[model samples]
Target chain A: MTDQRDDKEFAAFLAGESELADRYQALGSEQPPVELDEHILAAARDAAKVHRLEFGPPGGWLKPVALAATVLLSFSLVMKIGVDSPVRYEQVVTVSKESDSTLEGQSEPVFYEQLARSLPQRTLEMKNMREEQQSEQVIEEVTVTGRSRSIELKDAPMAVSILGSAEQSIDQDAALLIVAEYVAMLKTKSDSGRFRLQEMERSNESTAKEPALTASSPVASKKDWESIDKLQTEDDSESMLREIVRLYTSGSNNEAGTRLDEFLAHYPDHPVSVKLRRRGY
Target chain B: MLPGMANRPDDKVLMVRYRDGEVQAFEVLYARHKGPLYRYFLRRGLGTEPAAELAQEVWMKIIRTKDRYEPSAKFTTYMYRLAHNCLIDLSRRSAYKITQQVIGDDIDVAGLPATATANPEAEAIYNESVEQFRSALANLPDEQREAFILKQESGLSLADIAHVTGVSTETAKSRLRYAFSKLRQQLIRNRDKA
Candidate 1:
């Protein structure tokens, strides 16, 4: 019961203050040394410099240039690998089977030989045929090692005729012919890969001559599409700003100013900028 | 002390001037707050030297963070908060423990020259009461002690105390209440003994 009373008494005593509070006030009223003022002010100045160092330079142009380079390089690589490699060109071809009555027995082999060479070139020309006639034209015959298939060519008035003799087989499927032509083109292009490789080597040599241009150009850095996994994570802006400020206040004003200008341009309404403006930067 | 300087520009404006290479504005700010800040550390069991050192440190922190200053709060609030943190930091570094011995701790009350033989009995009573009060204040929790100091010495409102200590007004009030209760109990005990 007395402990409870003491708790109440304690509360009341604290509420009912004494002159000790006044005495404490008097003790604290003593004047501080004059040097203290200078010390603190100097500290504040140094702190201001630190703040300036942490938040000084804006990096406006550098970011966009970096982003543009990244985007352009990425897009160029993707196009180079994905969408551009399989393009097809078509042309129409007129086929005529030679009647070799003198070499009747050997005529089949000669016909097959000529057919193999002419078939691919003929297919190449077929794709260049006008779109209106594309559907009607077809491969009337296809022979692989004497096993032959004959397909009926649609005889529409617009159809481009592909004539062949009775001994030869013709497959007149338009879609199959188109695909075959595309495959043949791919083969031809692949066969000439060494020449293209030589051309690439020459371009690379020329590129090395103008290093600055190569470095600046977006197209020069195009890598394989799969290598995009190597892209760096974005840097932390606050730390970057700190570094920029440090650079600025440490007598690199021009570099710092450029970075600061860049940052302000990028983030016009940033709180850091407000602080910078207030600091008379 | 100059006329119309009572409604002076805020710290932010002064800081901006300072940033513009005007050192005088910084001096003015230093002059205005240095005494109070020094007193703040002194009252919190720090010696004159330590108080001055901490005051300098607080000001230095202010300078370092000047470029990041937002005038969302009063300059005094910001400065005192810095001082408070610096004191806490110093205490941690020095491992300084403040004892609650009142008159016997640093000064010898019995050794002081007698001011009045006429009221020796009353003087003894007063001294005892003051000692109990100091003991109770020392016994309070750190938060309560801080709240009481901020209120009693800094003359900050409960709201202002909350802002300085990063507590809500209700928490500040609660701490004050606890502090008051503890001190009141000690005072009453001294009165009972008398």
Candidate 2:
């Protein structure tokens, strides 16, 4: 019960009603020297204004420039990726013949790669054609005779016409595939032997009855040599097999590797496996 | 919990303005509390030079950390914490030369000599007891003196005292109790001689 009295007295002292509170209150407060206040306050004011630009926002004009550069980079990337859909020859839209005139005037390696990836079949064939011809040979433009006038197929729908012997070298097989599609298109339109497919140096005197190319008819220009090479890969299915091998070996897909094992059991003599054996796989 | 300064914008408002880069806002805050904060360090046993140095340092620290300061407590509570930390750092830097006793949490304020207000001689004793109490204020243990001074200077409640001194509210109340008890006894003990 006496402890309660101390609690009341202590509370009174803390509340400044007691004599002890009167004594502490009697002492006046101390102030920091004026110079210290000026020094500290001056520093506080200075801090608001003085600092490196990077610690805050960049200058006014820089943000737009950085934004523009970022946008330009993104656009270039998206254009380079092309479409995601499965590619087909039917999907090949023909560009205007007049477009060829402009394409033939410029020479840049970038244009060659753009034209190559634009058509999947031609990209593969173009790579092959580049390897075979060693890329020094000049490309010949094919001419198609329309009913009203002789229109060169040089600017035909496929990417080949886009090259048009511009100093930019491209895949020969790309050019041939374009020619085949153009030939197919022309054969239906011109019954008169006005349509002729041949090397630029070949005679124009050749007649319209030149065998209307059978749907499956081989391209006559490289029929014998290219046909034999195509037949060999077709018989072995080496291209498909090589692609599966590439996917498995690169560890890009576990499913591909599992399939490769199943494939090796049935076809252990597959060319890539045989090749790996020679390399001490 | 702050009262009676209703028209004056609080430290939090000034702090927010300072954060938004108005240097004048910081000047207002500095002017409002500099005396109390400086006196806190001074009375806490830092000599005048070290007290001034630490006061400058506390302002600089507030400026340096302004952007990260959230108004999580009363501005007085926050500033006093900086003062508390600065005192601790001074104590540590001086290798614990602060020989003040550890003020304990014994809140048992029982059976002490009763406060005397009866004698007319108490009036004559008051002036001298005031001087004695001021001397005793300097001599009180660190925690007791800190609690007393913070209460007298900032008008912080025991809860705010707990926050400023980094102790529980109960401990803060205990320290304040012990502080007033010592001051009362000191005043009366010196009253007779005076």
Tell me the TM-score of each prediction against the true structure: 0.39, 0.51
Flag regions of model 1 displaced more than 4 Å.
A1-23, A41-281, B1-22, B91-135, B188-194
What lDDT would candidate 1 get against the real structure? 0.51
Docking class of 1: incorrect
- Cα lDDT tens digits, model 2, A159-234, are 3432333113222232322233233333323343223334211312332222333333222233212322332334
- Isolated chain A: TM-score per model? 0.23, 0.27
- Per-residue lDDT value at B109 in model 1: 39
Residue B100, candidate 1: how far off, in angstroms? Answer: 4.2
Candidate 1 positional error at A175, Å: 60
